[model samples]
Target: MDAAALTLHDMTAADVDEVAAIESRVQSFPWTRKNFADGLAAGYRGWVVRRMGAMLGFALVMDAPDMAHLLVIGVRPDAQRQGVGERLLRRCIDHCRQAGLPALTLEVRPSNERAIAFYRRHGFAQVGLRRGYYPATQGREDAWIMTLALAADAA
Candidate 1:
C-alpha cells in the first residue's frame, strides 16, 4: 500500500467488523464484537486508518480526569511495518495532549517485544507489571504497564 494514500477517520459501527477481523488475526486473544460495541456505547474515542477505503489499522482510547488509557491498537498483518501502527499511535498520543491529558497508559503483553520496543521508541516507559494479565494456553501471562507523558507543545 502507498503511504500517501492513507487517511484516518473516526471509527464507526460499520468499521467494527473489519477492525475485529484484524484484531483476531493479530492478537492471541482478541476482543469480541460485543467488546467493541460496548466501547463505542461508552463513547470511547476510536479511530481507524485506511487506504483505498480498506481498513488498515485502528485504535481505541478512553479519557479519564487526568489520564488517558490506550485500550487497544491494531494494524492488519500486511500493514504491520508500513508505518500504519506508528501513525495510529502518534495520532492517539497527539489527541491525548490536545485533551490536556497529562499521560497515556497501556498494558502490553510482556512477550510482545516488537510492540514494547515500538512503544519505547515513541517515549513510553514501563512503570509496573500485572501478573497473569493475559490468559495463555499453558498458563497466564504477565503484562507490562507502560506510560507516555505527553508534552503539551507536542500537540
Candidate 2:
C-alpha cells in the first residue's frame, strides 16, 4: 500500500487493546499491556497508523533533551512490508524534529534482518549492540542499537 494512504494520529487510552493485540501478533516477545499503559501514563509520544479504520501499526517514542528513543514499534503481520512501519517511523522522526531533538535512536533484534534494513534505509546506522537485550523462547537475543541524526535544516 502507498505510505501516503495511511493517516497517523496520537494514540489514546482507548487504543491500548487494539495496539496490544497487533503488537502481540507482530513479535514473539511483545511488550505487556502494562508497558504501553505506563508509557502513555508517563507522557511518552505514542502514535497509531491507520487506514480505513483499520490499525496498520503503532509506535512509542520517549523524548529526552538531546535525543528521542523509539521504545516500541510494530506492524500487524498481515500489514508487514506495506510501508505502514515507515509511516509510523516517519511520524516519530517528525515529532522529534519538531521538538528540537537532535537525534533519534532505537534497538532492534539482531536477527530481524527486515527491520534492520528498514531502519538503515531510513538513514539510521548501527552504532552499537546490546547483549541479550530481548527475551526469546530459547533464551535471550541481542539487539542492534541504531541511531539517526536529524538535521536542523531538513526539518
Candidate 3:
C-alpha cells in the first residue's frame, strides 16, 4: 500500500497492543507494553500510522526544555520500506520545530544499518556513540547518537 493512504494521529491507550505487536515484529529487543504505558503516563508524544483501520507503525517522542528525543520508532515488518517510517519521523521533527526545540536526537543500534541510513538521509548527523547502549543476543551493543538541527523555517 502507498504511504499516502495512511493517516498519522496521536496514539491512545487502546493502541498499546497493536503498537507492541509491531514493535516486537520489527526489533530484536522490543519495548514491552508497560513501556508504552509509562510513556503515556509521562505525557510523551506518541503517534500512530494507520491505514484501513489497521496500524502500520508508531513512534514515541520525549521533549525536554530545549531538545526533543525520539524514544522509539517502529513499523510493522510487513510495512517495511513503504515510507511509513519517514512519515512518522517527519511528524516528530515538525513537532520539535513547532515547540521551538533546537534539535532532535535519537540513538540507533550501530548494527541497524538501514535505520542509520534512513536517519542520515533525513539530515541526522552522527554526533557520538554510546557504549553498550542496546542489548544484543550475545552481549550489549553500542549505539550511534544522531541529531538533526531544526532549521529556522522547519515545520
Report the lDDT tens digits of candidate 1 across residue range 1-155. 57778999998888889989999999989998789978998999999999988899999999999889999999999889998998899888888988989999999998999999999999899999999999988899999999998755465
Best by lDDT: 3
Clashing residue pair totals per candidate (backbone < 3 A): 0, 0, 0
Model 3 segments more than 4 A misplaced? 151-153
Which 10 residues in a row give candidate 1 its minimum summed lDDT? 146-155
Error of 1 at 95 (Å): 1.1
Worst 10 residues of 2 by lDDT: 146-155
TM-score of model 3 (CA atoms): 0.96
Q: lDDT for each of the candidates?
A: 0.91, 0.91, 0.92
Q: Which of 2 and 3 is the better model by TM-score?
A: 3
Q: How displaced is residue 11 in candidate 1, in Å?
A: 0.6
The TM-score of candidate 1 is: 0.96
Cα RMSD of predicted structure 2? 1.3
Better of 1 and 3 by lDDT: 3
Ranking under lDDT, best-scoring first? 3, 1, 2
Query: Native-vs-model 1 lDDT?
Result: 0.91
Model 3 error, position 32 (Å): 0.2
